[model samples]
Target: MSTVVYLDRISKAYEKKIAVKDLSLQIDSGVMFGLLGPNGAGKTSSIRMMIGITMPDSGTVNLFGQPFTRESLKRVGYLPEERGLYKKMKVMDQLVFMGELRGLDPAVAGRRAHDWCERLQILDAVQKKTEELSKGMQQKIQFIATLLHDPELIIMDEPFSGLDPVNATLLQDTLIDLKKAGKAILFSTHRMDQVEKLCDAICLINGGQAVLAGGMREIKSRYERNRVLLNFEGDNSFLQHPAIADYKDYGGQAEIQLKPHANAQDLLREAVQKATIYKFELVEPSLEEIFIRTVGEKVDA
Candidate 1:
């Protein structure tokens, strides 16, 4: 099926507090869909419902073209933000156990676990017990366990948590490769820059409701690029142009914010004539900017 995960007007609440309200989105194979929001924005609740960990108070969830079921979970792999490895168990054994629980044969599970460890650069720690490994190492072990059975729909919540830059990059590259191999991935993280770099589509949830959802290009295209980056060696008189709303000058560099319906081309023309322009280009609103503007609050990310 083209759609891997579908949430149709789903809502969830606790006691008298609303967690999520009428949230909806879709994930398709071969794309890393980012689930984004500020803290307590209903991301965790939505995910719990999506994976059958909790039922939604209203609406429906579909997985792999069918209604979500306990059995359907076998086709999905999840690595939650909370680590749950058995501290006493050897890393290799833990991964194999998780794989078997997902219905993989023991031998196959062991083989796949070994390969994943090597790929994740954690093979040397295979025989070590979970407690002996560093947090980063244990995190990699958990990552390996999540993928050991080779699931079709992969859900990683804060996957980069507790990982070093080098290891985080390794996991990111591996996820990209899995996406290329037709695995549907849903990434939930606070890192907007990483989301912008890794995801083609995104859903920004605030107060458990989807404030924005669409392909990255389509969503970004909807916002006007009113910010400009200019590097010049001469007079910065262009910063005072009528089109300019405000500006920040840093020596030869400047960040100019334009007024609504202002013409960037008009400002560029003025800048070129007034200074020896080294770099003159309009900068699009970053995902972080879009997030803050949409929710009207600063995201913890």
Candidate 2:
């Protein structure tokens, strides 16, 4: 796939504080790229620079293989972390207006907005004022507005915020379909589980710099599968095995963290000897674990 967005050593600052520092990453068509970071870690700064909402103090921003320009932004759709909507306007009207601002015909915009609302299960709210809708419903409206113009690149900041499980799944499946249709999607969210599920590649930032960047599988493969889940009855003395650094025992089930470079086989052998093992499996470190390991802090998500 062709590169849809590219940032070359981008840097940004406000007053004495550096918001983003020498960050470089690229997004390709049909790929879902996760721009992940802790709060105030420059994720918004980098995204703002990408769509010309703000400019980087150093390095370059490229969209569609060329220098950034306002004209090129027409092909980009951005849904910021802070929601913006005309509260008094009807939901459908607000969506159509947004579509028109992006160069869509008024009629085409209306039709698209209707179809989107139906697909997202918000058709009933289309005639209601934006102010009358629930936060989750309003979020879905903004999501529809983002895609109304059929932009080639979609950037969403906390797109799933305020969404219920059912609504969140609806949007997730929509994004998957969009990616299959060749749209390049870049989203920044605190939801590591969602990122792990949706993103093909990711750039993890901390302190305004990239701490980790690469394809999801490649990055995960770099970390050892040192976690173990065991379910057994009888004696639980295996939890004291030397190979295990720590573990939580819940009577018949245990979640274990193996010591660095420790042999999991040794732990398993010990467990079998002490208890009747029903299950023993070595699991890869989850994305959240990797995040805490790299960032040295637990994610609030």
Candidate 3:
């Protein structure tokens, strides 16, 4: 796939502090990409550069295979982490105004805004002032504004905040639909679970640098610990065997890590002989666990 967004040796710094340091990334077309990191890790600064909100102090940003320019901004939709709406304006009117800013005709914007409000199950709030609606409804309204312009690339920062489970799922489904339509989407968030579910690729940053970046499955497989979780219907004394490098008992089940030199078959054979092993399968680390391990190790050292 062709690159939709590319950052080459991008560096952004304040007067006395470096916010992002020599970061480079390539985001491809028709994929959902995630930019993840802890607070103050420069995820926001990097994204700001991508969308032209701020320029990199050095290096280049390319959007949609061209040099970043004012015209390119029309093809992009941005939902910032700090959401704002015209509190006194009716929901539909505000959405239409936002769409117009993105180059849509006023009539077209109004029609699209109404359609989106209905589709998002907030038709009743069409005429209500934005401040009159609940926070979740306002969030949906902002999301509608983001889509009403029909941009090719949608950039969302913390899209799930202030949303209930049902609404969050609704937004997830909407994003999936957009992906199916071949729109390149990038969202920055701290919610690892959502990233695990929705993103095709991810770039994890720490202290202003990209620490991990790749296809989710590929990244997890690379970090595999070669361990298995097992549950048996008998005594758990076999977990103490020397063949198990790391073992922990959790209620009726045990998580076992075999030594790199030891054969997994030997351990399974011993466990089967001693107990009726019910669950036995290699386990991959969760994104949260991987994040903790990756960053924690650096901090500890």
Candidate 4:
């Protein structure tokens, strides 16, 4: 339950533009935290500061409950969205080098490199040059490099990028296993739905500021569950009811977002009269919906 990474009142600006403004967030041991934002929202900038890739103009970064320093980074694993590998180097050699850079000895680094490739099902590619491997395989290599030194805090930016479903799921399971092992994990990704299922807490940034931040359940609870999902095979006249704010009808299915202070039970009664309801359920706003709503509102303002 100890804090693993903390950023207090961090601010970063590039020339005339601000990248992060008074941003603050914390991650605790055994927790998976999501850093979310639309393009140019400062998620990447904030993450860079967390790992000391760039210093914030003003603010503090504490890693592993201590003041930020290069030594602390040895206990922190980072995989940036932009992957780097020696094109001419063999997969195993490249991995070993990356491991050593993170403080492993040559023998230990090579051993861990081979072990990870086998566990990740990429052992065959060990002898091949990094340039010859597919993007997905190279990504797996980078993932191994991140864990080479057995870091306690893992930070990944777009970890699932360019991966097939099977490989993506493989990485997801690995991250979950790490969390169970008491490592604090932070990830920034555009895949909101996946984050919704995987992250325990989230900080949503817009225009370099955190517009929403909290435990997932607490944040979702603040929003009204006035959305209705209807599965019917007949007339869809209920979608036009006065209580319905907006709706999307796809043949036998309809997704309805109710107006403010709208009564869903009243709308359901009307829906039953027009269509033979096969399934009717009211559900909370998904993370995706909330992301759009919050970011859209910020943009409009």
For model 1, give the RMSD to the true fold: 2.7
* C-alpha TM-scores of all predictions: 0.92, 0.96, 0.89, 0.96
Q: Put down candidate 2 lDDT per residue, 172-194, tens digits, no spaces.
A: 99999999999999999999999
lDDT of each: 0.91, 0.94, 0.88, 0.93
* Clash count in backbone of candidate 2: 0
For each of the candidates, the C-alpha root-mean-square deviation to the true structure, in angstroms, is 2.7, 2.4, 2.4, 1.3
Pairs of residues at least 3 apart in sequence or in different chains that clash in candidate 3: none
Candidate 1 TM-score, C-alpha based: 0.92
Clashes of 4: 0
lDDT of 1 by residue, 101-124 (tens): 989999999999999988888889
Candidate 1 vs candidate 4: the TM-score winner is 4
Steric clash pairs (candidate 2): none
Q: Local error of candidate 1 at 32, Å?
A: 1.4
Error of 4 at 228 (Å): 1.6
- Score candidate 3 by lDDT: 0.88
State how far residue 119 of model 1 sits from its true place (Å).
1.0
- The per-prediction tally of clashing pairs is 0, 0, 0, 0
lDDT of 3 at 270: 82
